[model samples]
Target: MADFKSIKVTKGIKTLEIDNPTGYHLIGMGAQGAVFKLSEDRCVKIYTSPLQAKMEREALKAGQHLSFFPRLYEYGDNYNVIDYFNAPTLKEYLRNCTYIPESIAMKLLDILGEMKKAKFTMVDAPLRHIFVLENEELKLIDHVNAFKRIHPVPLKLLRDLNMMLLKESFLSRVKKLEPKTYEMWQAYFNENKMDYRNIPVDPGGDGEGVKVDSAISQTLIGAGHQGAVYRVSENKCVKIYPKTQHCEQEKDVLLSHQDLSFIPKVYETGNNYVVMEYLSGPDLNTFLKKQSALPPVVSKLLLKILTSQKQAGFKQIDAPLRHVFVTNNGFKMVDHVYSYSRIQKRPLELFQNLHERGFLDAFLEQVKVLDPATHAEWTKKPIPLTDEEAQLEIINIEGKTDSKRKKGKDQGKDRDKGRDHKKGHNRDRDRSQKREHGGKRDNGDKKNRNRSKEHGRENDRKKRSDRIK
Candidate 1:
């Protein structure tokens, strides 16, 4: 890399800051650090933390025997010099390829065998870390967690391969070449309800509420693995439970959080359904997918939600990111499937999961920017902020968010009016058809009466003429 002396790095929870003075092109990034392409043969792996850098250094030492892994030339406290070997990762490779060749499948299986022979664990061979070169070679990298790990098979690679862009096509080839391996994969993909066919689950009907489908007036907005959630009215939605007593458990979780606005208020409940406030907004998962970084207001809202749950006598706050939503009112947590019933608390479970996934460090970097002093102190012992305190911190970001929601509401209102107008137009059309049909019936009756009179007149004339003769 040219002008490398000027590059500086700062790490965040999910991302990193690279002050690259040399203008090196960025090839990839993760929780560990960013990689910048220096030239065709070399690149640098910048570490987010000293520990990760040390781990990678050690990984390089252990993996020296493996020709496919990146060769470590030199290392600093925060970065490492290694072979660039610019090639698409297997994940990228599979995504771009129109079809998977039988040869590639054979190569992958052979690689697994080689990994075992080399005493390398399956953890070292993630499809994303493995690269495919033009010379029919697979370059496997990233052995931070691969050392001495034990697994009968490459489970992560199997799952990653399962989530391939062209899943069916990839599987078809695997089934043809490796039948037993494909069978193992099929069973794993099915979870508890194993299906050999690997057909997609139909995204319709409440499993238990199918019998009561006729009574449902609203459209089914979401159907999950467990149950179907429907938007019934303007402010209310219903979750129809499975055949089991699942609704009881979910309802209990909701009833426990009646006091919190962050949770949807339970309006009514039935034996197999839960009628709750319909929160209209994108879920956290969807929002995060489109974002470059987590907004400060969102971070604050997350803290408050966790704190409130803890204060409300709930032991678990390990809510999935998908269950949380960003609404006009603010953030609200939904799907309390993992709360109240369990006594064991998962207070920092969300953060811990993020950290393990390499997002926590990048997110914390943002927190540091928002409040450096607090960030410095929280590093030693993390603490949640009060509602008032969080509100004060993100006041500016909150205002911007509110403005965006106002714009969205205006658009929503226009859409609703258009739908109403369409309904009214259909009703008017029906009324016009009824009036036209009624006029046709009346005209037919009048014509029939005139014909009867003419027939009577003709009969009378015939009788008079016959009498005269």
Candidate 2:
């Protein structure tokens, strides 16, 4: 084995070498190798571990059986360069959020199944190693601890004593640190609305809502486990529930602040179905198709929407262009299934249950203050686009239309009118379709639980007063 730094690419057809200021242009540093962007459409991974070449070969060969894995383009001298994907990682995709769309999540589950069938295990399945590329394809990178068998850790405990001690400590912490999150989860279970409780709950059903076939809408736009999105109407869309009740709650929070900015409007809703005002317009991805990055103006409008949401007391949505609707009017956020939340679990329980029972309506009825000053912090930033960038964007849009003319008739018309008023406003229809299958969050569930928890305590106090009576 030659030192990767010392080995020069000479006349071999196998290894293509380059000389640069840094020894190896770092792509990402992990347990095994360092990734590098070799070219625009290509990247290379150089293993830094002891058996760099061996691990690379093994991982590459193993990945050959899996579609989501990157194709092994070339491997030599402890370096392997393959297809370059200009998309975001799963971790980057799910910023401080949970619950993806069912359709996309199924695809991810499928990938997991394939990996399992092939006897591959990703020990550290954090969000970063998975990439969601254009064309809605999923690819896996960083395979340092892949394909290993695991031994289960079993613990035997003394039931009665352990329960008494552990119960107080755990519940005490829950009461202090994450009281709201705990209350939300308790409300969900108390009301039998555990449909979205986590992976492997009924393998995918909790019957909290109309049980729509998760597969029917699974083909909608999604990269990995985010679930599929479909076009519903010109002015509305819905996100199918992929994980939990938090999906519905996220939308509710976004809706409450509708007057603040360009967030989508929540219209009708079901256990799984949530109708929202469809945003027309191409996503930044479609608008910037083939371009490496977004122009200044488009990015500015997009950021403005995000800034507004944050100012409105809603966590920012972290998905890229796929989750955004970029229209002539501006930008609109489509998915909040994985929006940021401070509450760890069941963050949406209180708000969601309240909204369902018209409690929110009554609460807002008393409030006259709708402040825009919350978002004033954003005005200080320079606008994202320049005149030159906007002009280039318009030119690119025209060029794109011209290129699509060859597709013919209905296809061409659809492509041409992809920016039309009605269809344009219907940008996130797929999101609605995904949301329809999941059950709705019931505020009554919380109300019921609180009533139950208070019953015995209230009765005891009532008896004490009865003695006086």
Q: Which candidate comes out best when scored by TM-score?
A: 1
Identify the runs in model 1 with alpha carbons over 4 angstroms from their true place: 1-6, 96-99, 148-151, 165-469
| Model 1 alpha-carbon miss at residue 421, Å | 33
lDDT of 1 by residue, 79-140 (tens): 78788765666766676677777777777776666666766654335566677788768777
The residue-level lDDT of candidate 1 at 193 comes to: 39
- Predict model 1's lDDT versus the native: 0.55
- Specify the highest-lDDT model's number: 1
Give the C-alpha miss distance for residue 48 in model 1, angstroms: 2.4
| Model 2: residues with Cα > 4 Å off, grouped in runs | 1-25, 96-98, 149-469
- What range of 10 consecutive residues in model 1 has the weakest lDDT sum? 417-426
- lDDT score at residue 261, model 1, on the 0-100 scale: 78
